[model samples]
Target: MNLRRLKYFVKIVDLGSLTQASEILHIAQPALSQQLMILESEFRHQLLVRTKRGVTPTEAGNTLYRHAQIILRQLEQARSDMDKSSDTLAGKVSVGLAPGTAASALSLPLLKTVRARHPGILLYLNESFGTTLSELIINGRMDMAVLYGDHASRGLSFQLLLTEELFLVTPRGMPMPDGPVALATLQNVDLMLPRPYNYLRKYIDDALAIARVQPRVVAEIESAATLAAAIHEGIGATILPDSAARIIAASGDGVQRRIVAPMIEAPLSLCVSDHLPLSEPAVAVYQILLELIADLALGSQPPEAACAAGARPQCPEQLP
Candidate 1:
């Protein structure tokens, strides 16, 4: 009935012995036994079966275990929500981002908005691959993240922000075909591909396979800056998000962009866990992100211009 009793019951089931559970729970065995008895009494069912080896969960106990896990999670989330509300928007928000393009294209804007709007909130940024970011979010190590590739978790929800086409960037003077180059064209060319372990690399490889083309990879680099530098030196052409390639093209006088024909595009996702209840600050941050995204979709108009047209200020000049 109580969270403590439920926790003790789950612990007993996990340890399979009252002595072991009590040792882990740091309670006397008699007290732990009493707690279990109270839980069974409240449920009006025999929760565990005693055997010479140890205690095993009865059918009723198994059912309660499942429900107890959810209940405990909910209770913890509620407490977290209360704590967050009491403190207002004054806690650290850690965000994980995929390396290279997504970090530049998505994380930068979101961070800028946060800095301007929530100056009191501390921001921690980490760059990793999409799969790593997802695991961190699931484990409660990150509050939210922007990731790429497939999102197949039922417990996780995503909002597709944009679809970015992949492009092959080369030096300005290099001879490029007039049309998009097929993957077969890359067979002999030095290619700077993402690491094979990366989700983006897998997606790109799958796309290449669909076209029945094999590329000759010269190097695999993780950092966007390193990849950009490699491309700058004309070491090899790298496949990158169009936005990223465009940024590099604009900055590097010698770099030229060629839109890869039979384009490979990947969805950029804003992912959050459905099982975790968001704090008021987190909810506010999410809403702000949606508003900022809407503004971006509306040509990224300046706040003054948006306000003049009776549209809500996407990045208001006020802070709480």
Candidate 2:
């Protein structure tokens, strides 16, 4: 079957009229009709029934339409891939990132690395909660993502990047809680928690449930900076990855962070769809991420250590 004929058929069904389809496809009406006729002849079935208002698909047409959608999508992806390969280290990359620390701690570094190594590559970043990021990656809306949680999708392959412990953050000068405060301690404490649907929230809730503690949440916030500000204002304490908590504590006035007792740790995972192959630029960025993460884990140093070690920092924090 001719792909062009299939394209014509799909356009006809979409517009519901040959005249409209021809106008949209920029083909002569007679040519469009001829293509549709050829498609119907190849299928040996009536694909559309004519009505006074417009054309409607027959049962056979509907079946073929579904397959045509898939075929067209694959064709488009192939074209995009081909175009991408024509230029080395130059293409568009869309990445989904988990909210909070993963976005700042992981995705930001990877983005900078990509920009430096492949100046021609355009980077698009989206921040989402864990499940949403997973769905985006699987659907091809995102080329890659940094996620925190269990790898639940069989269609995705994950690499274990690092394990980060959770920390309890509070305003500076606040009396430190007794050693290893129980999850119940959060009850009646002003608490800034992630939305219930967030993967980090799920991890926090699971840990609380395991400890048989119920936390009285004061508010649900999304951004790490917002949550840190809330903590600094003494609105409530929040539990977050130590990397983020420490960063926030270092910057925020009078804010302190402590590791959560009993050590609720989550594995920071880099996820990619098994169906997609990484581009050369993306592969280079991923390798840099591996090296950066290894450096962080080996010495628990901030990413700025790269700068200290003779590499210029791609992102520099403004000194307060």
Per-candidate clashes come to: 0, 2
RMSD of each: 8.9, 8.5
- For candidate 1, what is the total of clashing residue pairs? 0
Highest lDDT scorer: 2
Candidate 1, residues 1-320: lDDT per residue as tens digits?
Answer: 47889889878887899989988889999988898888888989999999998999999998887677657655654665566544456455666667654333445666777778776566778777877888766655566776675465865666676566677777665667765777667767687887887767887887778777788888998776777677677788777776566655554433544445456877666677757656555666676656654564455644422211112222323222
Using Cα atoms with residue i matched to residue i, what is each candidate's TM-score against the true structure? Answer: 0.64, 0.66
- The runs of at least 3 residues in candidate 1 whose Cα sits more than 4 Å from the true structure, single-residue gaps closed, are 1-80, 83-88, 106-109, 250-256, 301-320
TM-score of 1: 0.64
Model 2, which residues run further than 4 Å from truth?
1-77, 80-87, 106-108, 173-175, 178-184, 250-254, 259-261, 300-320
Residue 242 lDDT, candidate 1, scale 0-100: 60
Clashing pairs in 2: 172-254, 190-236
Candidate 2 residue lDDT tens string, 50-137: 9999999999998888678556655665655577655556666676667655334556566777777778777888887778878766
Worst window of 10 by summed lDDT in candidate 1: 305-314
